[model samples]
Target: MPALTVLTGAATAAYSAALVARPQLLQRPAGLARNRDARTLTRLVGVRDTAIGLAMVLAPAGPARRAAVGARVASDWGDAAVLGVALRGRGTWGKTVGFAALWGAVCLAALRYDER
Candidate 1:
């Protein structure tokens, strides 16, 4: 579980950094460059993900860890919901949903570990 947490944390942090540093790189299915509003939202999402990753890494094992994992799960679900609504009937939506599901599973496992 600790390994899962570390891996997810690193991946999310990297993703967030990439979004901030080179938002253009996350084009295509992401479609973040479609408009200024989209780009702004993408940056905000990056910031939010960075915070989640930080929480996962810095929180001690126990309730604090559980809370961090819980936050991840919540945020992932929220992203899934938004994708479902905004990207409906699109291949990108499906891909994003799959990614969210994988992260959600990892966070759930971490939550269970923190419980013990």
Candidate 2:
């Protein structure tokens, strides 16, 4: 169960990073930027993610900690879904930066764990 807790933590961090990066990736899309509402929402999401990442980086046990924790868990889940879809007895590209980046953040956060 404790192992699962760490796995979930990593997944949550990855997912949150993915959420943060998705906006920067879509910012250049012509169709997406055309709609004012879409643009506004995207910007807001970017801001939110940036804020969350900053918060996670700043303090772990603060209010944002729960979100940071969730992001870690969700990220592993998303990656698993991607891998299952792309590698289940079928040849497909399992290439993407989102999950990798999130996993990286998980490692960063884990550095501060007391393991007590």
Candidate 3:
């Protein structure tokens, strides 16, 4: 579980970085233009994910780890909501939904591990 958490963090942070640095590649997948507003929002997402990823990697296990997992859960749900709103009625919306659901599942699994 710990390893998975770390991997998730790393992956998310990397992906977020890509989105912020070169959103053009994601224009189709994300269904967002590479405009100023979109880039700004994408950078914000990068910042959020970077913070969460770092917390997950650096926080101690037990309570600290659990707290990070909780944060991850919150972040995932929030992302899902944002995606739902932004991607509404869009054909590529499912991609964002799937991304959020995948992370949400990871967070939930981490929470379940914490319960044990």
lDDT string, candidate 3, 13-67, tens digits: 6776776777665666868877888777778877787788777777776788678
Ranking by TM-score: 1, 3, 2
Per-model TM-score on C-alpha atoms = 0.84, 0.37, 0.83
> So what's the TM-score on candidate 1?
0.84
Order candidates by lDDT, high to low: 3, 1, 2
RMSD to native for every prediction?
A: 2.2, 8.7, 2.2
lDDT of 1 by residue, 43-108 (tens): 788888888888887787777867888888889888888777877777677777777767878878
What is candidate 1's CA lDDT for residue 92? 77
In candidate 2, where is summed lDDT lowest over 10 consecutive residues? 90-99
lDDT of 2 by residue, 54-91 (tens): 44554545345555645543544554465556445542
Give the top-scoring candidate (lDDT). 3
* Candidate 2 local distance difference test against the native: 0.47
